[model samples]
Target: MSTANRDLALKKIELVPGKRVRQKSKLLQYIWFNRYLYLMLAPAVIYYLIFHYAPMYGAVVAFKDFSITKGILGSDWAGFKHFEYLFSQDKFWQVIQNTIIISVYRLIFGFPAPIIVALLLNEVRARLFKRTVQTVIYLPHFISWVILGGILINLLSTDNGVINNIIKAFGGTPIGFMSDETYFRGTLVFSMIWKEFGWNTIIYMAALAGIPPQLYEAAVIDGASRWQRLLHVTIPLIRSTIILILILRLGGIMEAGFEQIFVLYHPGVYSVADIIDTYVYRIGLTEGRFSIAAAVGLFKSAINFALLVLANRLARLMGEQGVY
Candidate 1:
């Protein structure tokens, strides 16, 4: 090469390194400026790393014939044997079906409950009355299902329960809400809605509050009625929030409330109430089938991840921004 060309090549290489160093310094400076904000986020990041992501390492047991004495790494590799065992069982299918049914019921019924409550609250003219209503509904969320379970038992028991006595007063037959198979699933769905719907409304309430007042003014000047304003102005603004929450909720479809179900359900209702989480509790902790339990837990996680991805893709296809 000519001396001029060699000199130009060296200059280009020097410029490239100088440009990269400037970019790196700018990134560090940006992070340093935002250090306090990141400091606030550190605890949450640490928590997921410690409690959620750290335990993921133990998922190796799903592929192992795990023994407490042998430990995770020392155990013999089973090579999908545990999953094959799970697939071969009829009870596995039953449990999966029960889980999907209960979750879908909640998705259909419970998902709309919060939105409806938020809308009603939005319409209320009396601040005092609306605040009281919100407090009354939100109280149940603070109480654990253990306390609520005892309360429900007294209220819904088939034999001389509070509700049953009221029914008998009206010359009606008592319903077996807790013990019978027919009513147990309904009871589960209803109780979940009653427990969670109020708490869930907080998000929708915030979404409603964020709507620009000018848009409502424009709608009113356009001669839109209150109902028309809600349909045309309110719902459209909150659609993205609804889609975001729904996508996140779909990721937990397999979790059918082990604490609630275990507290209320008995063998009579097992056909309908037995779900993946409860089954994991029974087979893993109660029965000490470590490998099988690990297999079930891992499988549940895979399904949840797939659903989250699918929901995000569908949301994007509908021309909305979804969590990626």
Candidate 2:
């Protein structure tokens, strides 16, 4: 609203009685006007409160020598003991290194994959072919990682796997993509890209759809080529979305697909593929070290939160609307 008009409205509201009381009435009326919208939002708000925020109370388990029989609040306080031991472990540092390296590999190779695919799909004039391709690629996103992991094991198995069979047919050596430490991380990255990149492409495609046709029309009139139009127009319009998704991704740098890794990793590939989440699962859940597990989970949350805030701050400094 214009400053003058807003001041005029406030003056009219103030003339009714106590200025603050009238202002409060206006705010209540605004809420009343949008009551149905708020009603629609209630379930989502309640979900987060119950499933996300309420469980935060259990984070104290990280600081306590927690016993399941004793419960969270009844446990003896261990102060920083859990965190101290977590930091002291050389294995913990190796896990951290693996996590960062895997996350970086995803960021470098997997991040731009969707953008490239979305751009290519956007340029395709054959709608039938495009739809077929989209459906084929997006199918994996709906399937559970367990199923995909099994399929990948069979497809890439060193002992007469389909891929190895093809290699042998072509007079090439059978390489262990999943079992060999040299190829394990790269295989993880490739499969990750193949599995989820299409889902991300949907986001980019949505953003591309929102671009005003008039902008493209203007570029065409100005004798711009398709590449020029994309560079000067399409990318600039979707810049905020790219920035927002990137910031959210940075926030989850500690996560390296726990489900996928858990299903696919074995002792042979653990050195390269084991991430922080898997380590926590081994010590915290399977080994029943509740306090240490809670501590590691809390540490991961703290790092993610800090990265989110930092990424948002940097995005705002760079004049982009980051995910707030």
Candidate 3:
């Protein structure tokens, strides 16, 4: 190569490194300028680091004998022994079926409840009445499942509960709402909707608030009725938010509300109410079968992660922004 050509190539290479250096310097300057924002975010970052990421290291116990004495690292490797035992148990399959059934019931009824409530609330003309209704409905969400479970048990008691009294007044037999397998799943789905629908509406309501008023005005000018405005203007504007929430719901299909089921279900209803989370808790905490429980949990996490990715991809394909 000629000296002139070599010099030209050297200059170009020098400029590339200089450009990268300048870009990095700008990034550092931006971070320094926004130091306070990062400082505010530190607690959340530290929390996830300590609680979430740190515990992930212990997931290896799922593949080990998992002796508390031997420690996680020193535990003997057992490969897929625990997983094999998990799948071999008929009870595990029953729990899996129950989990899916409950989750599907929640998805069908509970998922749409909030949207319907939000839409109805948006249509209300009286602001004071609307706020009162919202406050009343949202109160259930703040009650812990342990307390709510006791309240439900009392309310559904066959002897002297309010519901049974009304049933007896109408010459109908009082039903075992909590104990009967036939009624247990329905009770769970409805109770979950009652507890969470109002709280979930907050997001939908915020999304509705973001819709442009001019869109509704334009629709009205074109002779659209209230229903038509909602269908065309309101629904379209909030479609992305709906899709995002649906994707998140789909991601959690394996997790069928551990606290609610654990608090409410007795052995009589276990055939219908026992889900993967509850099963894992019993096996791991109560029976000391940590390896088996860890295997089940790891499997659940894998399926959830896959579902999340698939749902996100499908959302993006449908021209909606997904939860990345």
Tell me each candidate's RMSD, in Å, in order.
Answer: 1.5, 5.2, 1.3
lDDT, residue 250, candidate 2 = 96
Residues 178-237 of candidate 2 have per-residue lDDT tens digits of 889999899888999999999999999999999999999999999999999989998999
Cα lDDT tens digits for candidate 3, 173-277:
999888789999999999999899999999999998999889989999999999999999999899999999999999999999999999999899999999999
Tell me each candidate's TM-score: 0.96, 0.92, 0.97
The window of 10 residues in a row where model 3 has the poorest summed lDDT is: 156-165
Sorted on lDDT, best first, the list reads 1, 3, 2
Model 3 RMSD, rounded to 1 decimal: 1.3
Candidate 2 vs. true structure, TM-score = 0.92
Residue range 85-156, candidate 1, lDDT tens digits: 999999999999999999999899999999999999998989999999999999999999999999999999
Error of 1 at 136 (Å): 1.1
Question: Of the candidates numbered 2 and 3, which has the greater TM-score value?
Answer: 3
Q: Any runs in candidate 3 off by more than 4 Å, and if so which?
A: 1-5
Score residue 59 of candidate 1 by CA lDDT: 95
